[model samples]
Target chain A: MNHLASQLVLVPVILPLLGAGLCLAFGRSARAQRIISIVTLSIVVVAAGALLWRADQFGPQAVNVGGWPAELGISLVADRLSALLLVVSTVVTLSVLLYSFGQGIVEFGRDTPLSVFHPTFLVLSAGVSAAFLSADLFNLFVGFEILLAASYVLITLGGTEARVRAGTIYVIVSLISSVLFLISIAAVYAATGTVNLAALPERIAALPEPLQLVLQLMLLLTFSIKAAVFPLSAWLPDSYPTAPAPVTAVFAGLLTKVGIYAIIRVQTTVFPDQPLRTLLLCAAILTMVVGILGAVAQSDIKRLLSFTLVSHIGYMLFGIALATEAGYAGAIFYVVHHITVQTALFLVAGLIEYRTGTTQLDRLGGLARAAPVLAVLFFVPAMNLAGIPPFSGFLGKLALIQAGTESGDWLAYSGVGAGLAVSLLTLYAVAKAWNRAFWQPRDEHVDDDVPSTGALHPGQNTVTEDKVLRLPRGMALPTLALVAFSVALTVAAGPLIGVSQRAADELVERTPYIDAVLGDVP
Target chain B: MSVDLALIIAIGVLVACGTTLVLERSLTRILVGFVLLGNGVNLFFIVASGPPGAAPIVGASDERMADPLPQAMALTAIVITLGVTAFGLALAYRTWQLEGHDDVQDDVEDALVIRRAERDDTSASFDEVDESLPEEEGADLPAVDDEVTRENDEDHESPDDGDPR
Candidate 1:
């Protein structure tokens, strides 16, 4: 049973790798690929759940692969932080997969190549899991590359001019950032003599001040790019919308968190110092402001959602920057909430695209009257994202704010206040989406009674497009699952926060993580 | 550090090549730019760890003649770059197939929807803004095909019946 606990940490990563191989090896049949992919993901979700339970009981634990000692082998760890993330990722991946079932990104003249999508998505999921589990900087880099490599395929899956263009930029930025990460790791090893994250504190503490700052700054830049932080986020909006719905949903929910997770790991465990914390706070504020501003400016739902993803990252940064037990806990809880809510909203947007054949707000109207259930699904997450009371998003935001205030950091407090304000702004943007796409009156001229009218299906009255806007069940089920889980998050916020708080304490104390690396942290 | 010097030259070459690609109008060249940029950064990683040979892997000889950490990092970076380059090339090929050109500058304002939003600025301006899409960018996009089908259902069904392909 104790050994099973270690295996739990590897499941999310392993399942995806197996799924990718199954998809690639059995590449001839799309149906086989889809089934294999879904089954693997289901297993990962179960594993994530079990790991969460184990972490709940035993606290932060590390597993060395092949039974090698931690120092000599690759390691996968599940602390409160990683476990929470694992659960969130599992939920999001499941939703996106569900939404993509039966209705695989169908276009006019061409069919979406399912063979590529299934395998790449599996690789991506693997990468995301690897990022969460890694206890070493270099392995973390491999995870980033794996995640990025999978994304490049997913983003470029359509092989369209725009997707390609966007993918080009995405790859370039990723390349530059990754290189920077490599450089930072190298310097750290040269100065500190170890890249094992657990060993980093002692090694880093021994280094001279200026050198440490340089290495830390390098890592900061590297992760900022991955998280789509203010200056480094130019590639995101242009690229994300062009992929299939499932890909977008996963990217929205899972991808950026990996970057945020890396920042938390490095800053807290490796570089537990003051200067870095202050810098993170500054970056958080800027990311929030810039992201919301971008969201406010866009009328396209997908693009708007992308910007909101950026703004929400700021909230995570806030908790990480405070570097307090409470702050870290709040950040961890917020990550779980944000992933579920964000992915749900993106999937809902895909539903809208399925109906009206477009995501532009102008072309969409009176959909709430049409697609009430979808509206319900979308409304829950959108309102949650805006941080209205009772939803996980609000709880997460409140936790972060309370932690900031308690920490007696005026700058951080103001940033939290700004974050709250952005939550409202986020709400406003979400409301704008609701109003334009679901509440606005329909145009009479375009209602030429096209062949798409009449006869409600078992679950749809959403639109009057293409003979009933028939959304495959697979598409809606995954999204609904995510929404339900988000609702569960809201309901269970008390306990989840409690556990996260404990995890947060562990992070702040740094004894366990540091002891794991620096050998019992005498 | 001999490794540091090697890192500088390799990344320098990458940076220069990337800048040149960014300047080119041809999408293929621009893609090449991205590839160069990625490789250059890989060089930065190689340089960062005391040249490329410092093996940081545990127990691979305690003397630390080479760093496995950077090498491992570079392997990931290289694989990721390969994925990106593959996508970029496919996109470039698709663009050439569509507009009959490989240059990005020529396609800047090609989408009818966004152009109408920008130029008309009237009763339809809001409409254009409502759905601000440029043309579909790649050969494999569902939206492009969906939009084409929708437009065809409304107006002409197969505009590309006489397509060069």
Candidate 2:
């Protein structure tokens, strides 16, 4: 059973890649591509669930590729955290793939060219899985590059003028971050003999204090850009809103969290003794305050959601900064909650865009009356995003706040304060969007001017001419499923929190993971 | 391990030039910068591999063999950079085809924010000012909106019409 669990670590990373190749082979038939992707991801979802159960039942599971020694060859490790996140992320990706199929089928018909989207999407899933499971820094870099390369193609899939422009910024920024990551990896390798995560702790501990700090900061800089933390997050809102809704939704759901996941792994395991708490707390506070402020200013629902996505990253960073078991638990829980809720919200926004011609607040109205189900869809996630009670978002925020207050530090107290304020501001922003886009009467002037809406450059006006008044059942079902899944997070918060606590304990102790990777070495 | 001054100097020079070019507006220049930056980082990996030695083949030489790991990683980095270069060139060419230039444009939303800031209008919402303000004061707001709309229209359309280059 133990050996079987260990071998299962490779499934999440390998299956999707194999699926991608098959998808490319069957590129002519969109239906074939769809079936292959759905079957591939559904199988992954089940495997991830089994992996999580096994990880919880056993300890961390590790597999060395090519049967090489742990330190010499690449290793993939799945402990409680990676397995749990893998389950949630795979579920989210599967749903988003379904949602994209809905969008593609409805807009472009079932026979639309199946060449790039499915294969690239599968490659992205593979990349994300590899990043989560990788036991070494270099493999993590490769994982990032794979996912990013896939994202670059996905973002510019249509090659629209706006998409091209947005994709340029996205690609350039990602390239710079990748370069920085490589430089840091080089520095780490130069300082320590091995890039293996299991071996690095001892060597990194022996480095001079200042040198350790430099290495830590270099990595933090690279990850901060990827995570879309403040001062480095300007590119997110500018680029994300221009892509197709499903692409934006998946990117919002998975990509930045992968960066945060890396930060958590590195901070807790690699540089455990580094006293960079204050710097991280400051970044958290700023990311929260500034991100929400930006969200409040946006008139476009997608961009507004993008800003909130940035804002909520602050919450996870806050949990990590607290550096307590409760804090880690809170951060992990928040990551799960945010991934579901944010993706659901974006999918809802896509549904809204599909029904109406635009997502602009000024131009949108009467949605509640016109489409009650859409209203319900949008309302549930919006409230969840704002941390309303009886939702996972609220539970996750409560956990973070509880962790912060337990620390009893002034910095944490301020973080708690900023967190509460940001929550309120998030509510304000989404509520404003709701009131304008749904509750109010459709402005007659804007309704009459729908033909000219495409000429209006700033707004994401995808279907300006032929407005699809009815929501596609394919799209709505997956979105509803995601929203329901997020609600389930609240209902299952007890077991989820317990799992995260155990994961946090393992992270704090660090031996379980190190042993899982290197214990059998001769 | 003996350090190579020339290799260090080359890494520094390449990275410096890459950073400078990356800050430029032109997409082609940025793509070039990205390639240079990637090469410089790859060179750093070579340095990290330690002093040069015979190829890392088993029993190839009696002397210390070069570390094979960093070379493998450097090769990976080179492959990734090559993929990125191809994508970046394609993107730049697409931009040229569309806009008649390869320069990145300012984000329209950001430019609007700057315009609002310059006018001392720190209102949270852009389109809501008319409803909040009195008739005469509100009258001036639509003109600002029109000005922005015109600017955006010209921004998208002017390049094709004029073909300045």
Candidate 3:
């Protein structure tokens, strides 16, 4: 019952906001902005770690902002689930900020005026943290708005035609989803007379079955589009790959995962009965099959990775679709693993783009000979993404498949089948990229736009040849650090999965979360 | 009841028009459609208040006061919509300035991907369309051409030199 421990939930959100404001105040000073952002994010990461530990020890913690009562004012709650996601996301963001520091220094001189990146990135961090910490539905929508606004700026950073075009499609899709979400919120409020998530379950359950189904379906559709589950995911591959590398990395890694997190939160809490489990299973199957099919068809590495990102979300949906404790546990584990692995892979992709001037599979070759460190960076995460054995990805997939088998339903079985197929195809896609980009001899027929002739012939031992493409230490170091973090997940799988199981238990039981916010309400 | 009915009908019309406009290829139309959709949702929120009555201000009399929560939510939604709409306009303007048209190009490869996915044919000729399309020179090249072109444009027009837009 330590007061400070109880109030620790707000630190993740407020620190980013304060940092964003400070960066804005220090406008046009790139050096100051970088120091403030990195320092602030590091502290936020520490705060999130403490919050997660406290939540684990004390069975979820809540604090009412401004001392207002729950259901009347905004409240921030840190259950094991939110705390876990907050820590992982801040770690990813902090690394990306460092990666961007490396990128900005290389693109503009050290004294240039690229001040917009810091504040906008901090705001995006705050919004994401707020979304995780929010205990109310309306506040979640506001969180989405803040993040989407920041992302719109980040995506179109240079205002080039391609970036602008991609930014427009992304904004329109996101705005449509936000509107649908707003309408659903209105519908929920009209039916339940409140938006407090903790107070939602009993009230939502009290509604007529058909109305409940409609309301649940509306919310599902909104989250589905945001999560980029099949049929609704057409915008993602086209939208994400066009941004600057770090921007694309964060967007691919974190944004859709936020949607998945919300789905797990709402599905397990507000609609714990899971009336639409069968439909969810169907969406999971299609998301896997269609997404991977698209991935295998892609020639461009970024688009290929983007497609895999969409496909892997189906695995998480499979866990959620099961609605069992093991299912929740597997989904949570996959989320953490996917966030780090996907971000690391994208950072590697960025490095490849830095070296080769393109992510087109046809143009890249002999990177293994040219930059062995970069090849290892790509190969490890790519294998992890494909769920190779002894890696965290395989463990997470095994957990999910086991959960599906325990369910013993045909749909669950099919979902597990689709999961396996997707994993194999994922391996195929990554291997194809690896062979084409790293193994094959450099494509000498590549267009004149590529100026680097430093790529060596495969099997040639001239390792000390003059390398034309010099990787910035700032960029390469952060990429390697992220790769190390992904490796750490594999090494730490046992305790990590244990934490996920505890989180799943909290998610399934629902009482810890409810009581945290409502304080012993029957 | 009548007021709620009218509000509901207005929402339906706005949503219908908005969805239609959003489907168009033009960016400006999509922006307008977003505004209309926002308005429709805002009105729906107001209608959800149910039998609007006196202001929610605390007083001696106002037993049937409007819920006020939806109104507050609607006001916040309006501000958000305004900000997004302004940003959308700025993006549209920039797209127009750069590309000389505001039409949102349908993703060329998505349709191709879907077509390939449907046939489930051999993977050998899958990317035939992409390969056959005479690889546009510098297609995957980053920002260099655009930057150089922009610098030239700025040099020609001193009036627009200062604006980052």
lDDT of 3 by residue, A1-522 (tens): 567766678888888899999999988787898889999999999999999998888788788888888878878888999999998999999999899888886653542347888999999999899888888889989988888899998988888666787888999999999999999999898888889899999999898999999999998999899899988988899899878889999988889988998899888889999888999999988998888987887867888999999999899999999999999999999999999999989988988887777776766778998889889989999999999988889999999999999999899999999999999999999998998889877744533222121232233222333344678889989888988988898899988899999999999999989888877311
Model 1 RMSD vs true structure: 11.4
TM-score of chain A of each: 0.93, 0.96, 0.94
Q: List runs of model 2 lying over 4 Å from the truth.
A: A1-4, A108-113, A444-455, A458-466, B122-165
Name model 1 segments beyond 4 Å from true: A105-110, A444-470, A517-522, B1-27, B30-84, B101-165
Best by DockQ: 2
Top-down DockQ ranking: 2, 3, 1
Per-residue lDDT over A155-253 for candidate 2, one digit per residue giving the tens place of the 0 to 100 score: 887778888998999999999999999999998998897899999999998999899999999999999999998889899999998788888999999
What lDDT is reached at residue A5 by model 1?
Answer: 60
Candidate 2 Cα deviation (angstroms), residue A94: 0.3
Roughly what TM-score does model 1 have, to 2 decimal places?
0.83
Better of 2 and 3 by TM-score: 2
Report the lDDT of model 3 for residue A7. Answer: 68
True contacts kept of each: 0.22, 0.49, 0.49
Residue A131, model 2: lDDT of 95
Ranking by TM-score: 2, 3, 1
lDDT of 2 at A46: 92
